[model samples]
Target chain A: MDLVNALVVFANFVLIPATAYGAQLALGALGVTLIYGILRFSNFAHGDTMAFGTMVTILCTWGLQALGVSFGPLPTALLALPIGIAATAALVLGTDRIVYRFYRRQKAQPTILVIVSLGVMFVMNGIVRLIIGVNDQNFSDGERFVITAREFKAATGLAEGLAIKTTQAVTVVAAIVVVAALFWFLQRTRTGKSMRAFSDNEDLALLSGINPDRVVQITWILAAALAAIAGVLYGLDKSFKPFTYFQLLLPIFAAAIVGGLGSPLGAIAGGFIIAFSEVFVTYAWKKVLGYALPDAWAPDTLVQLLSTDYKFAVSFTILIVVLLFMPTGLFRGKS
Target chain B: MNMRNLMLFAGVAILFVLTGILQSWNLSLSILNMALLSAIMALGVNIQWGYAGLFNTGVMGFTALGGLAVVLVAAQPVPEAWRAGGPGVLLALLVGAGVLAAAIALHKRMPRGRMRTITLLVVLTGGFFLFRALFDPNAEAIEAVNPATSGYMGGLGLPSLWAWPVGGVLAAAAAWGIGKTALGLRSDYLAIATLGIAEIIISVLKNEDWLARGVKNVISLPRPWPVPYEVDLQQDPRFLQVAAEWGFDPVTGSSILVKLLYGGLFVAVLLALIWLSERALNAPWGRMMRAIRDNEVAASAMGKDVTGRHLQVFVIGSAVIGIAGAMMTSMDTQLIPGTYNPLRFTFLVWVMVIVGGSGNNWGAVLGGLLVGWLWLIVESLGPIVMSGVTASMADGPLKAHLVDSAQHMRLLTLGIVLLLVLRFSPRGLIPEK
Candidate 1:
């Protein structure tokens, strides 16, 4: 019973929240990795792109709420996700046409493209701020929690209660479904095969009559969709703030690079690795330790490795270690 | 200078003159001072990116370190706080550094095996607990020493100008550590690493209350020598008589005099940097750096230590940025960690560098002045521009929102400017010859 109580406490704080955060990071990493794979440039604008998509989803969610639309037991954001994806796709496609296409034609260096994306990031950031002022916007409306702590305690008859947030559950489910569909599309579809070919060898793919433009377009659309879903889910789990999304760039980039920049499987693994490290290092293990250990052995301190404010440092340390040891990352997608 | 460059500088001068004529002399002088600092920041970036092709997104971190230096070197010491926990805090820091050094030495000396891993873990865990035990209590005590005002151990109370070079050294040390790790990696990896380091530095500044009072801020720092306070100048009879002879109010004259002094100091620093930069660019070392940047493979084949050069340039550039940051903080007479946002400190400087011309020091200075002017002007003009655009529109939330959000237009306008320059004039206004 004591062990079970410890498990409950661990799950409540470390496991569940990390899993939800990991899923959001995985989706975000997948988008970043895909862009790195196909575009051959690190998109500095990716975080702002996520903010733009989330802003659109939030606006649409507000509009739907006004129209008396509701998704019972789930966020109205889920219903608004498709519109967000579509709008994001349109925006990205337009951006590519206007800004990135010229660079592609020039065959500019990747570093140059990165700087160009910084310009795009600025514009997108400004637009988002203009549309939705820089403040926390709470959009999760339908249900707050899947299992309340009090209900969990009553059911389990334990001192420690395990509460699962509705957004967390939805995030994990949505992430799994999205990942599965993405893998299926990439593995089984013809267009996806063409994209793979292009990413593998651009000249060879062109020689074999794979349309470069189409592959680039489809990549942008898929990436935009992924970013939109990830952004909306993240906003639902936490509060939506433009600056926070910008800050998320570090962790997202860490995950993508740690997973191997162009590898999807690596991105998912890297996301979980970063998310778990951040959560575990910051979590105070005192409650769980108190439950698991005998009274005499139990510690009095918080037992946290680092303060929660140092969360970025956790990801950064992990990123540096990975870079030092494995420059090509775990899955060895590309250097 | 060439005709085009001369014309560009002339144009920037005209803008400043126009600001003074149209607005107030105080505003123009303040903008000029800021522009001078921005130019220094841009020059630092140009050294790295233009000379070495290293992408350092951690400019904010270096700048903040400079601000921290000003506090640590110039602010009055909090004797009470030091009495409470100063020695303990120093001992803890030394222990922490010793532990890290020991771990690194162990990693190097010990063979890779399970036993080694176990030993390393034991040492680290024990060290961490030891560190926490020493750190937490001492930090708490330090913070408890009159929490309202002087809760943290303060500086040496040196002249504030000393903080400028100290800031440079502080930033250089940090850059050395970062560059040592990230310089040899993939180009984008360096960018990401720098970006992460910057965020971490900021978080440290925001949370570490025992250092610079964190978010509570450190205000009323002493001014550097040779720049008199406006209040003092106003009280001086000689200054009042001079003001009267010049047909100006003493208050206005005093303020203008103070700004002019600041502007003179800034100009001296900017000119020195440009001269040094020009001399270096003309040297053989500059040629080698450019050669390395243009083709690292060829340069490495020629036996150049590419990574070492990159690290060197990175350190040098960061030191310059640190100096500029310290200067800005001193000018502001306060150190607010919260205000060091990346948009203003990091990317905007990048815009200045890129728009000025990457390989040219003069271009950077011009870019800094022009963009700095535009950034401030946009803020002032945003509402006016929006109101003018919405004058024909009906009174509604949409109009109100647009007018209210006009300040954000600077970002959009900056983006447009960057994109336009990259597209049409990728070399920028003062392209490298």
Candidate 2:
């Protein structure tokens, strides 16, 4: 069926890839939102934090591969993720103690904190580059694809085939697990409740004997863990490059803000929105149209709204639009 | 000036002199020129952040636009490319502008209803397709004209110096648009918006080949007037005689002379800007801006136009950055869009402003010269330093990596310096009096 073929083409190009990308963005946004909620700053260093986590994970993955260890059907990166998260947590905790604690003690303005984070970003960026160099490193060494295009075509007897990469599947699954655990921790746990209370009213929470330092520490650790998992999953899905992770800051910020900064549910929604918009705008829909349309009615041109190069522009435009209409964001987390 | 300020400036001068004594005068002069430019950039940022407390992270974008201005205003025209598709491209741009204007007008005039939304979408979609149809074909034709060199519609072949102000105007226009949209929002929002806009501006520069030949680069741009080429100076008999009298080789004399001329011009510009900025800072308007920055709510209560002042300062600052960017491109004699990155253009300038002393004009100049000199010195010294550190180590991949990654040491050092200053002094080298 031509319609089935069209649907398959749409799923392959737009739906599946966007979902995977959205999951990565959601994980990234979750980290950013958590920081904004608890730390009370946007954390300009978040992208570099992700890069640092990914760098540690990558080094661990390489070490594992050298030791003849792998996850078999999944990437070896999965086995190395926990070590990455732990290392990232340590790094972030150290950074807070050294650089951010002074500012926190000063009770500096959020804008000042943002500038301080820029300094941290530079240092983290340097560390990543020094360790891994500026070149792309591919660490996805196990199964390449869950469903090969040829196999899909043979099974479906359709003109278009739907192929899903193993990384994409893993990204979606890992993201769901992470999000569920995070929600559960936030909703049910005492530390999570304390964090929520602190975020809600810092003075009131302090008055209620909630340890501000502990809340801050837990926030950093959770944020670091999320950043590490997101970074490793993203690196697996695409490729590990420090500059690309740095660039991802724009979209991640866009996602966090659009979802309403400091709102977990909003962050996930914002990520999907940004991812879908970027993919839909940049994707050439000529083939899908050709499959669905009557023979003579098929369009002549590639129906891409914008070039792939302008994908950053798409996310930026969405951010600007959201900022213009809803300064507090979709879920009204904070102004 | 105070004794401390005088000593700081003297220290910067000594550093340059040391560079001249230790390295070649040519290298020292080159560094001086870049430092002068960096000072201008720092002063621009100081105007926004110091005077108005606006956090603009799009300095790279404004600087890149300034570079674009040089190519658009000074480069030799590619007649064939223009003849191929120039008019169509212009028309397409006009149509696009008209569409946006119409949409704005419709939004203002139309009542809030579904009909308005439908009409707006219809107009936008139709205009986009029409614009694309015209733009794509013409751009392709222009790009096809030579495809090797001169594949883009080039400039008016004006004097290169003219591009400096044109660059300011271009950047000012962009800043106006951005400030109009993003000003009056939360401070961090402005920072994020500016960051995103900077990236978009760079992507435009990289992809729009029909404008400036994209990544292929536009080379051999005419130098600003009165700075003669070294070869021309070398060929002059009087110059050669003068060089001989000075006990210098003609080639070396000419190169040094060219750099000196450039340095003189740059110093003139820097002095003029410093004078102007100092005057402005002492003016009543400057007092009002500082007052507004210290407490926006209070300033608003006093009937000051907070957003308007911010937008004004943002534009002025961006214009200054744009001028510096144009000067840089003219000095380089080429426009390489790929080389424009935030680390070099944006955050580095922020460091200079912060390190120099935010609210003081002289402090910015000091910060610029010191940081610029330190940046270059660190770059040259990094490999040597790394090699020295690794000299006692065994020959292995670790040693090799340490040596190879020495270039990245500058970033780490810069970050450390920023953190140290922020933690210790917070007000930078020369605190605001």
Candidate 3:
């Protein structure tokens, strides 16, 4: 019983939250990795892109709410997600045409592209702020929890109880479906193979008659979809704020680089690793320890590896270590 | 000067004069002061990206380090707080460093295997706990010591002037650590690494209440130059007489004089930096840096230590930025770590550098002045433009939204300006020779 209780506590604090967070980060990292793999430049504006998409989703969610639309026991954001993704896809494609195409034609270095992305980041950030002022917007409306702690406690008759949020369940389910579909698309499709080929060797792919423009467009569309879904999920789990999304860039980039920037599998693995580390390190383990240890031997203080405020530091430390030891990342990326 | 460069300077001068005539001398001088500082920041970026091709996206972090220098060098020490935990905190940090050094030595001596990894982890885990054991209590005690005013362990109580070079040194030290790890990587990797470190630095600044009081903020840092209070100046008959002779009101005269003092100090520093920058750019060292930047593999093939040169330039560039940051802290008379947002402090400086011309010092200066002027002007004029567009609209949410949206056009303008410059004059208004 004690063991079960302890496990439940651990699940409540560390396992469940980390899994939800990991799914969100994994989705975000996938978008970043896809772009880096194909475009051959780190999109610093990726976070702002996420923010812009999430903003669109939030606005649409509100519009739907006003129109008396609702998703039973789930966030109405799910219903609005497709429209958000489409809008974001158009925006990204337009940006590529207007700004990035010029640099691509010039045969500019990747660093120049990265700087141009910074410009795009600013523009996107400005647009997001203009549309939705820089404040926390809580738009997640519906059933709050899939399994309330009270319900769990009543069922289990344990000292500790686990609560699963509706958003958390939706995030996991949605992520699995999206990731599975993405994998299927990448593995089973000719266009996907061409994208992989183009990423592998651009010159060879070009000579082999791969439509570079189509691959680029497809990559942007997929990235925008992933970014939009990830952003909306994250905002539902937490709250929508433009600046927080911008701050998410570090962890997202960290996950991509840690996973191997150009490798899809590596990004997913890296995201989970980062999410788990951040959650586990910052979690105060006194309650679980108290349940596990003999009464006198139980720790008095919260045995946290670091404070929660140092969450970014956790990802950063991991990123630095990964970069130092394995520049190509966990999987062999472009070294 | 070249004709293009001369014209750019003339344009900046005219903008400042217009600001003075249209607005007030105080506002004009204020903008000039910030522009001068922005120019310094731009110059620092020019050294890295312009010379050595290092994408340092951590300008805000280095600037924050400079702010930390101001707090450390100038703020009055809290004796009671120090007494509570100062030695213990110092010893814990030393022990933390020692533990890491020992772990590194152990890892190096041992074979690369599981045993080494286990030993290293053991040492690190033990050290972390031991370090925490010493650190937490002292931190709590220190924080508890007069929590309202000076709960944190304070600084050296030295004059503000000492902070400028100290800030440079501190930021240089941080840059050295970052560059040592990151400079060998690709440009994008360096950008990511720098950005991560910067965010980590900011998180530390925000969370570590013991250091610079964190979000509580340390205000009214001592200034070196004379800052005449307008009321005090007005009370002085000799000051009134001087103001009368100068055909200036006492209030405006005092404010203008104070700004002029800052302007004079800022110019002195800017001129010194420019002189040094020009000398270095003309030197063979500068040529090697440019060569390394243009083609790293070729430079390496020529037996140049590419990473070493990159590190050197990175350090120098960060040091210059740190100096500017320290100067900015002094100008504001406070150190608010919360205000050091990467968007405002880091990316804006990059815009200045890129728009000015990456490789040219004069271009950087011009870009800084021009961009800074535009930043302020757009911010002031955005509402008017928005209102004009909304003139046909009814008084409602849409109109209100448009007005608010105008306020955000500064960022939009910044992006458009940057993209346009990159497209039209990729080399900048004053192309590098």
Candidate 4:
């Protein structure tokens, strides 16, 4: 096989999946970091929120499909995403009003708020599971792959074939658009600037006549939107399962922390870093290495650093390393 | 100890009695036994969160370690598997430890430059491969012994009761390591770090098949009590008379007796822990911990090693959880690694501690019993309520689906309970004195 073919194979297996996963994580991390910045607590319910949103989107997608609605080349889930975001935003805002507002008024410790979020996590997790039983749900209804492995192999006349899923491409593009919108809002828009001000210095922002509650409401709304998008993208790419989303909490938190808890840029950077590291470490690279190296240097084993089962371990390790060296994360935040 | 505490405890007793009346005593006793263990876990969490104000979200990890302890200390050893590669496994473990030590030493000794980094990486990279080379084959050989049942190298062939305290010790050791790295961070970071560590511990437990049989599970763990089995109790002369007097058959009576015996053991352990915790809480050390928790800056200014205190409490609390975990395994008579989820093992305990009372030992126990009982009751009640609600609906897939979805109501109820408690009684039911 040609070097181009080998590179394509490696990219297909490792790079593409990681990029898609990274985008999903980045969006999730952004929501996490935003909450951390504004709310002054690590929202433990983030994963569950994602799951809840995804569950809503799936339900909506099913409803739409039942009504004979389709997105042609794109997944029907994409059409249902905005509705999902709206439902999620309402859910989050309602939770904040009922559960979190009391704590905020009490001026309770961040730990207490964290505990409250855990409560929210349970509620959201339960609601998601209740609405859509705890089995995997596939909602993607479109072309499965942008380029199939067989088609690529036929075109390239190579032994190795490269396949890219449509969902993966959608995830990356949606993530970019979301990140761009978020940054522009934060830097160039009125509400976004007010949020940054509040995040930077809550008291000063309050003194400047910024409605703290308004900023908080907007933050939750934005976070809910991001969480919904990320959740749907992930569900489209991989099957949607409630427990898997809960498990995603660790890696998402890792990404947010490694990027710096309240820094958007850091969260994005950390997401890619965590995703790539997890993918690369667990990946068996022997085939790609064999193709890249000379015939004399072809390896016998899989040449994997760690098994795929230890993917969580990879993210944990990276998180610990980051926490040890740069506790503020790669990008600085209030902490 | 006081009248209010007594009343609160009486309330719990009334609930238990209600459960016994509504359900069978056997089921109630099972709930009680689990509540007793959960109280121990809540006590552990209380020690950390209440006494030291440390946010530890890694209860599942410590609990898993406790489970691991059972497997290591009690299970019947697979001699053939051990003989096949036991030394190799031991040597591999040693190499791994040595590599870590050497790398740390090299980093500290060598100048903070590229040479030091390169040397450390080289040592680590080479050691990992070497260790794996030695470990993987032995692990495969050990796992290959009896793939269906005892593929893993079993425990030390000791009485399983020994595993309880040993589990505590093992968990304490893990906690100490975790605390060393994590205790210095902010509360949120510490929470995330502990969570990550817990995940790592679980991954190890689930993936390392040679050690604990992984997902295949290690069943028939030895119990501390010598209570007769249901069948044997039916044959027993004394038990038959007792069962006859109680107006019950042998099987049910025997099961209740076994559960009661286990409950007795658990109660003894719980009392001992509470006594120790109470003593500690009232003493100068406990006061110091509360002082540190309340105002770390002032405590540190007064020359207290804040992180050290946090670490101490963290280890002690985790050890208590570890003991409870081991006890839980003994109760189940099996070590199922897959069953340890954060929602069940970790967060539920937090709710227990919080709903019980954060700083009070009695509050934790009361909360544990209350939440544990509710958790069980809600699970059963959800379907009943759902069926009742959906009864009016026509018999179709929609109605059937609604009834099926009711199982999830337990978690929602738990969340609502926790939120309500936090909202109305921020100090919990049995507030700290």
DockQ for every model comes to: 0.86, 0.83, 0.80, 0.80
Interface RMSDs of the predictions, in order, are: 0.6, 0.7, 1.0, 1.0
DockQ of 4: 0.80
Positional deviation of residue B105's Cα in model 3 after best superposition, in angstroms: 2.7
The alpha-carbon deviation from the true structure for residue B68 of candidate 4, after best TM-score superposition, in angstroms, is 1.2
What's the TM-score of each model vs. the native? 0.98, 0.99, 0.98, 0.98
| Candidate 1 runs further than 4 Å off | none
Tens digit of per-residue lDDT, candidate 2, span A1-335:
27888999999999999999999999999999999999899998999999999999999999999999989899999999999999999999999999999999999999889989999998999999998999999989898999999999999788778899999999999999999999999999999999999999999999999999999999999999999999999999999999899899999999999999999999999999999999999999999999999989999999888989999999999999898778889998788
Local distance difference test scores for all models: 0.92, 0.93, 0.91, 0.91
CAPRI-style grade of the A/B interface in model 2:
high
Q: Which ten residues in a row have the lowest lDDT in candidate 2 chain A?
A: A1-10
Which of the two candidates, 1 or 4, achieves a greater lDDT against the reference?
A: 1
Error of 1 at B407 (Å): 1.0
lDDT of 4 by residue, A187-292 (tens): 9999999999999999999999999999999999999999999999999999999999999988999999999999999999989999999999999988898888
Residues B146-235, candidate 3, lDDT per residue (tens digit)?
Answer: 888988898899988889999999989989988988888878988988898888888888877787888889887787555655577789
For candidate 1, lDDT tens digit of each residue in A159-256?
87889999999999999999999999999999999988888889999999998999999999999999999999999999899999999999999999
Clashing pairs in 2: none
TM-score, cand. 3: 0.98
| Candidate 1 global CA lDDT score | 0.92
Clashes (backbone N, CA, C under 3 Å), per candidate, total 0, 0, 0, 0
Please give, for residues B130-217, the per-residue lDDT of candidate 2 as tens digits: 9999999999999999898789999999999999999999999999988988899889889999999999999998999999988999
Fraction of native A-B contacts kept, per candidate: 0.77, 0.70, 0.73, 0.77
Error of 2 at A220 (Å): 0.5
